[model samples]
Target chain A: MQPVIEVKDLCKTYQDGLKALDCITLDVHRGEILALLGPNGAGKTTLISIICGIVSPTSGSVTVDGRDIITDYRFTRQMIGLVPQELTLGTFDLVRNTVCFSRGLFGKRSNPAYVDDLLRDLSLLNKKDQEVRTLSGGMKRRVLIAKALAHEPRVLFLDEPTAGVDVELRKDMWDIVRRLRESGVTIILTTHYIEEAEEIADRVGVINRGRLLLVEEKHMLMRKLGKKRLTVQLKEPIARIPESLSSYDLDLAADGSEIILTYDIRSSRTRITALLQDIKNAGMTLKDLNTSQSSLEEIFVSLVKEEA
Target chain B: MNLEAVKVIYRFEMLRTWNTLMQSVASPVISTSLYFIVFGAAIGSRIQEIDGVSYGAFIVPGLIMLSLLTQSISNASFGIFFPRFTGTIYEVLSAPVSPFEIVLGYVGAAATKSLIIGLIILATAGLFVPLRVEHPLWMMVFLLLTCISFSLFGFIIGIWATNFEKLQLIPLLIITPLVFLGGSFYSISMLPPAWQTVTLFNPVVYLISGFRWSFYGISDVGVGVSVMMIVLFLSACLALVWWMFRTGYRLKQ
Candidate 1:
């Protein structure tokens, strides 16, 4: 499928000569959720701002659904909905008016019914007449989402949508995002929460400093880089891992209560059966055994660390 | 041109004015009325006429112009500045609307508010002094041109201002003094020749003189020069605003 948004060789240099983005290129597919995972000051927001046309890039070009963002700004902007990281809303305006006005800003005709449905979906229908400033922080974030979707954009960019939000609101936002994706809207969200990316992202891109380190299917990435740890609980405390088990990448607990064996999942033979035999031969009695796979968080950290 | 976008922004801004009706409309009207009472009723009683026009009537145009200029700048500057302060300007900047349309909506609404206040003051002035519009057409022309030009100037100040203090800076230190020195009360011709020449350099003089000429058919400067001066200032303001949007000065990161 043709990408809904294409960013090519994008670079940004601030007035003080701090390079915010360096030759970064990316493509966002239609109707897919792509989570950009980055640390603070990792240029995620800068990239989003450039694509949304809030900040101009130093060099390189971006095209949304085949339209240049700069040359065809009006049409290109109409195709995008950006829920900024900041909670920026007109405090005095009614919830309904704010959303409808956003639609009008995109040159869309007034659609009261559509706006009503949007507010209802976000659980803001009851407060439609209330002033935005009266709403809670979470509700204000929902209003931001409602306004962004007011124009029925084809691509939605959520910049740290769950930041500072309570768990309940985060769950609600996840549900809303799922619904938007079901409606065929392409989503690109920036987040520092690895769990969030692991939970919802179809594809995850890890960026650090000013460069995108890697982008891969979430499951594929996990399977390729994921390591499984075989943890064994000894019947009694041991002073250390016996020399016989030293061939395996083994770690001994400081208290000598357990042993951890690490191995890649993709290896043709995990040699778990052999390792088990070796442990038995070493005269160690395992009271319990369990295995845990590495999470996306670890993969992200290692990727950033490798670059650093 | 995205007329719908312009209308949305314009309506939003006008609605804000209505929400602050006491500040936006009532305050200016009441304040200008005080000027009518002090300068018109009390002061006029002492000085019967100036250049054959009643003292009360003579100051009417100047008073209206003063309020119009100050109110126009305040309204437009505050209109844009509030959005910047609250970071809500991102919504407008990210929208499909063009810069020209954004300016039209904001400046248009600001000018409309000032015009409403100007008209209210004019009506209130009628209660104190018998007013005449010898060139009714010219009076309207001056009123509208003044509102638009000053509103545009306010827009520039809005973009240039980085803080609240800066927002009120130009309107207070620069504009208020200019209007006062522009013969909002007395004619420049009454001043010494050198002082009159210096007063001629003040742009506000042209605005007030031309507006007063429309009312009583008398002016410190020729009506043609006043019109030309206003047009020239309007063009300069428009050019500056155009450059601001093109360069994304303060509007874009």
Candidate 2:
């Protein structure tokens, strides 16, 4: 089957002479989570804004569920849900009224049971009649989600969903994301937190300065770019490397506490055996040793810096 | 304009405006009462009937239109300005609702408020100075036209305004002065010919004169000219508002 959302050669240039997106091409599957990560000026919001039909694209076009976003905007807009980074809500409105009005805006008839179930799922049933202005920050966030999901769109775009949230609220939002995923909703998340993408995304797309650096499945990207470091703790602090051990090519950390070695994961020869032999020949005893791999965060930083 | 979408937005905006019925009813009634006490009693004492009607009865129509225009401007301008200020407009923009529907909702609500307040102020005037409606249907027609025209005018101000101060600036600096000089309190025939010709430049004179003609069955300006000028102004305001929405001028930017 064709992907749920396809962008051919997407480019967006504002009238103020800002190049927001530069010939970006990507596809999103039906149910997977695609996390788009980038720096501050990285065009993440611009991409989502274009897809949601809010901003006018200078060039290139997007399609949702086989409908062109520009040509068939009304139908395409009906199929997409967007949770903007900004918390925009009618504060004087009641929670239930707010949700119902949102659903009605899309020409949906009044479904009291559907609205009640939505509020109940978001844990807003108790605050249904209370004005939104009286709600806490976390409750307000949930209200935004409820409003976005009111029309039951097939795809949901969350732009920096957890930007100002605390730990507990972040966990709550993540739980909601999981629930929506289970309900067969495709999620596209953009965030400044690399770990958010690393923790929950199936595929990661790193963008910087209006250009996409990489887009790959999480594990495959890790395996392809993963770096391993082996650290060996010495039994006795070595003052210096012996002349006989000079071929080992290792750096003794400051305070002469440990030796560090770096190597690629796909390499057949990590040089561990030769290094162990050289250490034995030099009469240095190894107390403990372990190998570790780099995380998505390290890869993200490297790519962003490379783009810069 | 898609009628269905426009109807949906109309319901939403009208309900939101009606939600403040207390402010809509109370403020205008109180302000019109003050107009009756200060303008009708004090100013009428020095000014005699110039058009074969009591001074108190002559200016009532103009005062009603003044209240209608000012409140309509406030209602529409603030109605659109608040959504932009509080960011709720982003929600409306992202929804399947079109800009035409948004404008219809806002301008319709403003007209609704203006018409309701116009009726209320008229009822309040009956309590202070007795009113005899010479042509009741024409009176209603003028009320409807003034409400809708000024409501559209207010819609234009809303689309152009960027802040709260700008929202208020047009009514305070432009609308109020136009009403004051538009013969709301005095007949334009009382002015010299040069000043009378200059008063013709103010669009609001036609609205007030037309409305005053509805009440007394006579006016300083011809009724045909007054109605024609108001219709032209109404169409121009609507076109400007439509252009603003179509181009997404300050709204989308």
Best DockQ among the predictions, by candidate number: 1
Tell me which residue pairs clash in candidate 2.
none
In model 2, where do residues sit more than 4 Å from their true spots? A234-237, A240-257, A266-269, A286-288, B1-8
Q: Please provide, for model 1 over A216-279, each residue's C-alpha lDDT reduced to its tens digit, 9 standing for 90 to 100.
A: 9999999998998998888888998888877888898748978888999999988888888998
Poorest stretch of ten by lDDT in candidate 2 chain B: B1-10
Give one digit per residue, the lDDT tens place, for model 2 in B1-253: 3354456566767777668767877888898899888988888778888678888888898889889989989888877788788877766676777666777777887898789889988988888787888888988888888888888888888778988899899899998999999999899999999999999999889888888888888787888998899889888997888788777787663
TM-score of chain B of 1: 0.99
Question: What's the residue-level lDDT of A109 in candidate 2?
Answer: 72
Candidate with best lDDT: 1
For all candidates in order, the CA lDDT equals 0.93, 0.84
lDDT for model 1: 0.93
Name the weakest run of 10 consecutive residues (lDDT summed) in model 2 chain A: A241-250
